[model samples]
Target: MLRRWISTLLLGLAAAALAGCSSTRLVDGQVESFSTLTALPAPATYRIERLPSQQTPAFEPIAALAERALARVGLQRDDAAPRLLVQIGVQASSVPRHGPSAPYAFYGPPWAFGGWYGRPPGVFGGWYGPPPWAFGGWGMGGPTPLYRRAVSLVLRDAQTQAVVYETSAVHENVWVSDPAVYGVLFDAALNGFPAPPHGRRQLRLPLPPPAP
Candidate 1:
């Protein structure tokens, strides 16, 4: 009986490995989008509006990823004659195997990516950049810990300065690397584009191919 059980477990592991080799991992998140713009502005151009925290060069990589997402969604980047103002935010904090997490814990409820709750002004505004905790060995050690991560984008009319669209995407996972999954997060955030569905929904997109 013991021998049979061992063989069965080995076969199951082998089958899973084979499946992974040919399959792409999915980056899944909960997305919520709201849009007041009935129609996109003519020319459909936009520019990135960096927050105070996003002014540094450290944020370039995220901006690049966001640009790709924008392009995919049919929005063009034109700083000179932009019709839209775009702002993007990414934040993550470590989550223990057990206990309350800080980023979204203290409040009534935790907020996830692609969505936002009506929290105080400083909560999301203050900590929208890189996390203070190091992510050095999150995946290296046994029983990798997970992170509660979120991404959001705010779009405003350039001329009127009124927010016309807002979308956010939040996720939780063991992967601590941001750049690797950012494009997908942004894509998920902007899933419905100019006019998304009314309420929150889940999205799963193919993760980028593994680094060579």
Candidate 2:
């Protein structure tokens, strides 16, 4: 029993050590930008188009949030090259934190320590005995959850028919269970893009200093 107790204690300590690594975060920031809105006539009404071939569930909420954001930025929605073309594309998925075949174990007190059978004084006056029934076995344990997501949104110029700017935002430490959060994040990302004038003239968005 005493032996089992020691074993169980060690196992528990190990498990606690592992639990320290577990972490979670909701709605990491987003990324976004637009073409030179200043060059084009101020858009009054605009059209929001769903990106071609995107089937993920995160799309709708992102679309709704983007529409509100564009409206706030003074661009209207239009489909037939009226002014600006707003398009939304998204991808969401999870990757396991642990390897596929990770091992798991059970832990409990030793049978002799306080478990099933206690060691009464042995023949030579030594204490020895089998573990108690209450003592548990190893190899029995529960599973844990790990989830993550990668999402992207893009804005283009309708008349020029070119991607004025595109943004790819990642929410690393989240389960992405709620779509509303995606929309909220989309709004926040839209705010991150500065006014068109601040964008890169050729590629737009502050040019990264020449790659070292």
Best by TM-score: 1
What stretches of model 2 exceed 4 Å from their correct place? 1-26, 30-41, 52-62, 99-145, 194-212
| TM accuracy, model 1 | 0.72
State the weakest 10-residue window (summed lDDT) of model 2. 107-116
Q: What digit string (tens of lDDT, one per residue) describes model 1 on residues 1-212?
A: 99999999778867766776567778789999999976666889999998776765556767888999999988999999999999888765544444334343321122222122343322322223223222333332333345566778999899999999999887777553445566788899998778889679999888787567
Off by more than 4 A, model 1: 1-15, 99-143
Each model's lDDT comes to: 0.70, 0.43
Deviation (Å) of 8 in candidate 2: 21
* Candidate 2 TM-score, C-alpha based: 0.48
- Per-model TM values vs. the true structure: 0.72, 0.48
